[model samples]
Target: MNNMIAPSILSADFANLERDLKRVSEAEFIHVDVMDGSFVPNITIGAPVAKAIRKHIKGIMDVHLMIQNPDMFINDFKDAGTDYLTVHIEACTHLHRTIQRIKEKGMKAGVSLNPATPVCLLEPIIDDIDLILIMSVNPGFGGQKFIPYSLEKIKQVKKMIGTREILIQVDGGVTLDNAKEIIDAGATVIVAGSAIFNAPDVEQRIQDFKSLML
Candidate 1:
C-alpha cells in the first residue's frame, strides 16, 4: 500500500507555528486537531487559528474535528481552507447528513473512530466517506502511547473497506519504529504528532517516516 505522512499540529510549537510548519514542509498534510472542552477534556485551536495555519502551510490542511456538534463548524472550516474535514462518529447524531454537508462544502469528508468504537459502526457510511481515521490512543491529547488493539482495528477496517478508494488513517503515537507496522496493517495515511514535532530533528524525523513508506 502507498503511504502518506501527516504531521499533527497538536504537538507543534504554538508560539512559533510558522517555524514548526516549515520543519515539516515535506509532509503530505498538516493534521490540524480541533478540540473543544465539551467533547474532550482539553481545548485546542478553532477555525481562526486553522485558517492562519493554512496560510503558512505548503501541504494540505487535514483538519480533524475533535469537537462536539461538528456540524456547526463544517462550513466555517471549509471556508477557512480545509482540504479534508474529518468528524468523529460518536459526536454526530446525523452522520450521513454531516458527511453530505461536508461534501457540499467542497471538502473531502472523513470519519474518525475512537479506540473503543468498533469498525462495524462505520459499515453503513463507509462508502460515503473519503477517509477513515482510527485513533490509536484516547483523543484530546498528544504524546500518548499507541494502543496495541488499534492494529487489529486497522486490519478489520481495511477488510471492511476492501477494494474501496477510501484512505485509512491511523492517528496518535506514530513513530519511526511503529509506522511501518501501522502501514503493514493497511493504513494509507499516518498522523504523527510528538513523534515528528517533539523530535530533536524535525525535518529528519519527517524524512525517516517517509523513507519507511519508500
Candidate 2:
C-alpha cells in the first residue's frame, strides 16, 4: 500500500493558512486538530474556520475533534466539508451512535485514541469505524516526542481490524526519523505537525517525509 502523509495545520502559521496549505500539496489530506479546553486543555478553531479552510483547499479535510462533546458538532463539521471526522473514543458517550451519525452525514467516521488509551478498548467498536487515529503524543499539544509504545498500539489495532479494511492513522511527533517505523508498524496514514509545517523548506520536508513511506 502507498502510505499517506497528512500535515497537521495546528502548527502552521494561522495568519497565512492558505499559503501553508499550498506548500503541502503533496499531502494526502490536511489534518485539522480541533481542541476544546475541556477535552485537551487548549482552545483552537471550530466550525467557521473549518468552513473557510474547505473553500480554499481542494484536498481532503481529515478533521480530528479533541473535544468533550463531539456528537454535538458532528453534523456541523460534516456540513463544513470534513471528509473524515474522527472523535476520541474516550470523549464520546455513545461512540456507535456518533459514528453512525457521521456516516449518515456522508462522511467517513474515525475513532481516535490517546497515548494512554488502550488499543483493546476499540475491539468492541472497531467494525463501526472507517479509520483509527492513534495519538503518539498526548492530545493537547504538538511537536512532542513520538511515544515508543504507539508502534505496538498500531500493530494491535491493525490486527484487530483484520479483513475489515479499516485505515490506521497515527498523529503527533511524526518526523523523518520515525515515519518509516510507524508505517512498518501498520499505520497507513501519518499526521505530522512541526516536522512538516515548521521546517525551513516546508515543501521539501513534505516530500522527504513522503519518501520515507517507500
Candidate 3:
C-alpha cells in the first residue's frame, strides 16, 4: 500500500487558495474540512467552496464532514465533486445508511471518529467502509498536539481491518515528529494541515514527511 500525504485545506489561505492548492496538488489527496458550528465549535466552508475547489484540484478530494446531519448533505457534497465523503460517527445516528448513500452516489464512503471515540464502534460495519479517519487531535482546529493514545487506536483499528484491507487515515497534528510512529502503528494515510500549509517549503515539507515513512 502507498504511504500517503493528504494536505488539509483548513490551513490554506482562503484568499490565495488556488495558488496554495496548486502547490500541494502533487500530494496524494487534497483534504477538505467541512465544519458546522453546531457540530464543532467553529464553522468553515460548505458546498459552494467545495464545488469551487473541485474545479481547481485534480487530486482526490477527501471531504471530511465535521458537521451535523451529514447524511442530509451527502448527495450535495458528492455533487460538489467529493471523491470520498467522510462523516463523523458521533454525528451520524444511521451510519450504515449514510455509507450506503455515499456508495450509491459513486463516491468512496468513510467514517471519522473524534479522539475520545472508540475504534470498536466500527466492528459491525468494518468491511463496509473504504476509509477510517482517526483524529489524532481533537477536531474543530488544526495544529494541536498529537494525542498519545492515537497510536494505540490506530493499532486497534488496523487489527480489525486486517485482510479486509480498509485504508486507515490519521488526521490532525500530523507532523514529522509522529508520522512514522502513526504509519507504523497502521495508518496508511496521514492528513496534515498546519504542518504542511504553514511550512516555508510546502513540497519539501511533504517530501520530508514521505522520507520518514520510507
Candidate 4:
C-alpha cells in the first residue's frame, strides 16, 4: 500500500494559519484537529477555520473531530470543505448512524480510538469506515511522548483488518524517528504535528518525512 503523510494543524501557528498551511503543501493530507474542551481538554478550531484554510490545502482535507455529539456537526463540517470526516468512537453514541450521516453528507468517513481503546472494539465497524486513526499519545495535546506499546496496538489493528482496503492511520507523537516502525506495524497514514510544523524549516521537515514513504 502507498503510505501517506498528513500534517496536523493543531501545532500550527494559529495567528499565521494560512501561511503555516502553505508550508506543508507537499503533504498528502492536511490533518484538521477539531477539539472540544469537554471531550479532551484543549479547544481548537471549528468548521469556520477549516473553511478559511481549505483553499490553501493542496491535498485532502482530513478533518478529525475530537468532540461530543459529532453527528450534530457532520453537515457543518461537510460544508466547511472537509473531504474526510473522522469521528471518535468514544464520542459517538451511535457510531454506525454517525458514519451513515457523514457519508450522506458525501464525505468519506473515518473513526478514531483513544490510546486506551482496544483494537477488538473496532471489529464490528472495521469494514464500514475508510480509515482508522490510532492515537499514540493521550488526546488533547501535542508535543507529548509516544506510547511505546502503540506499535503492537497497530499490529493488532492490522490483524483485525486483515485483507480490508481500509486505511490505518497513526496520530499523536508521530515523529521521523519512530515513523518507520509505525508504518511497519501497518499504519498507512502518518499524522504528525510537532515533527513537521515545529521544525526549523517546515517544508523541508515535511519532505524529510515524505522521503521515508517508499
Candidate 5:
C-alpha cells in the first residue's frame, strides 16, 4: 500500500492559515487537532475553525478530536466538512457507538490510541474502524519527541490487523529521520506537525517525507 502524509495544522501560523494550508497542499490529508481542554491540557480550535479550515485546504480534512464526550459534538464536526473523524479510545465511553455514528454521517471512522495505550486494546474493534491512529507522542501538544515504543506498537497493530483493509496512521513528531522507520514498521499514514510547518520550506519538507515512501 502507498504511504500517506497528513500535516497537522496545530503548528501552522494561524494568522496566515490560508498561506500555510497552501504550503502543504501536496499532503494527502489535513490533520485538524481539536482539543477540548478537559481531555487534553491545552485547548486548540473547535468546529467553527475547522469549518473555516475546510474552505482553504484541497485535501481531505482529517479531524482528530481530543475531547471529553465526543458523541456530544459528532454532528457538529460532521457538519464542519470532516472527511475522517477520529475520537480518542480513552475518551469514548462507548467506542463502538461513536464509531457507528461517525460512519452514519458518511465520514470515515477512526480511533486514536495514546502513546501509553497498548495496541491490544483495539483487538475487539479492529475490524470496525476505517483507520487506527497510533500516537507517537502524547496527545496534548506538538513538538515533543517521538516515543520509540510507538514503532513496536505499530508492528503489533499491523500483525493484529492481518488482511484487514483498515489504515494504520502514526501521528506526532514525524520527521524525515523517522518517517522511513515508521512506515517500515507498518504505518500507512504519517501525521507531522512541527516537521512540516516548522520547516523553512514547507513544500520541500513534504516532498522529502514523500521520498521516504519511495
Candidate 6:
C-alpha cells in the first residue's frame, strides 16, 4: 500500500470541527478516535458523531474504536459511513469473529495493538485483517510523546507481514520531526493528531507530512 496520512480529529477544534476538517481535507484519510471511558479512561464521540462527520469529507473515514465490546458497534459505524472500522485487539474477546463481522458489514476491518502488545501475537489473525494499527502512545488521550520503541515494533511488523498486502498504521504523537523516520520504519498509514491540527498552518503542516510520504 502507498504511504498515506490519516489526520486524527481528536485534536481538532470541536467547536469548529467542520472548519478544522476542511483544513486537513487534503489528507488521504480522516481518523476518528472513538473512546469510551471504561476502555481508555477518556470518552470521545460515538457513531452519531461519525455519521455527522461523514457528511463533510469525501475521503476515507478511519474510525479507531478505543472502546470495549467493539463488535456490538460494527453495524452502527458501518451505517455511520465508516470506511474502515479499527478495533483494539486488547478489547476483543474473539478477535477473528469480530474481524469477520466487520468484513461482513461491508467495511474494512483493522486490528490495533497497544504499545505493550507484541507483533508476533498477531500472527494467527494477521492474514485475516485488512490493516494493523500500532499505537505509538497509550490510548485514551492524545498529544503524548511517541514511544521510541514503536519504531522497532514497526520494523518487526513489517518483517512479520512480509509480502502480505496489509497496511501498517502508526497512531499517536506523530510530528514532522519524527514522521519520516516512522515511515522509513514501515508505517504505511500515519495517524497524526496535535502535530497537524495544533500547528500554525494546519494545511501546510499536512502538506509537509505528505511530502515525506513514500
TM agreement with the true structure for every prediction: 0.98, 0.98, 0.98, 0.98, 0.98, 0.98
Consecutive 10-residue window with the lowest summed lDDT within model 6: 49-58
Clashing pairs in 1: none
lDDT of all predictions, in order shown?
A: 0.94, 0.91, 0.91, 0.92, 0.93, 0.94
lDDT of 2: 0.91
Clashing pairs in 2: none
Candidate 6, residue 114: Cα displacement in angstroms equals: 0.4
Worst 10 contiguous positions by lDDT, candidate 2? 51-60
lDDT string, candidate 5, 1-214, tens digits: 7889999999999899999999999999999999989999999999999998888889889999999999999999999999999999999989999999999999999999999898888988887899999998988999999999999999999999999998899998888999999999999999999999999899999999998987
Report residue 209 deviation for candidate 5 (angstroms). Answer: 0.6
lDDT of 6 by residue, 36-90 (tens): 9999999999999999989888699999999999988998999999999999999
Task: Summarize candidate 3's per-residue lDDT along 91-139 as a digit string, tens digits.
Answer: 9899898899899999999999899999999998897999999998889
Off by over 4 Å in 5: none
Tens-digit lDDT string for candidate 4 (1-214): 8999999999999999889989999899999999999999999999998998999998999999999999989988999999999999999989999998998889999999999898888888887889899999989999998999999999998998889898899998889999998998899999999999889999999888988888
Q: In model 1, which range of ten residues has the least summed lDDT?
A: 51-60
Give RMSD to native, each candidate.
0.8, 0.9, 0.9, 0.8, 0.8, 0.7
Per-residue lDDT for 177 in model 4?
95
Top candidate, metric lDDT: 1
**Runs off by more than 4 Å, candidate 6:** none
lDDT of 1 at 163: 93
Candidate 1: global Cα-lDDT?
Answer: 0.94
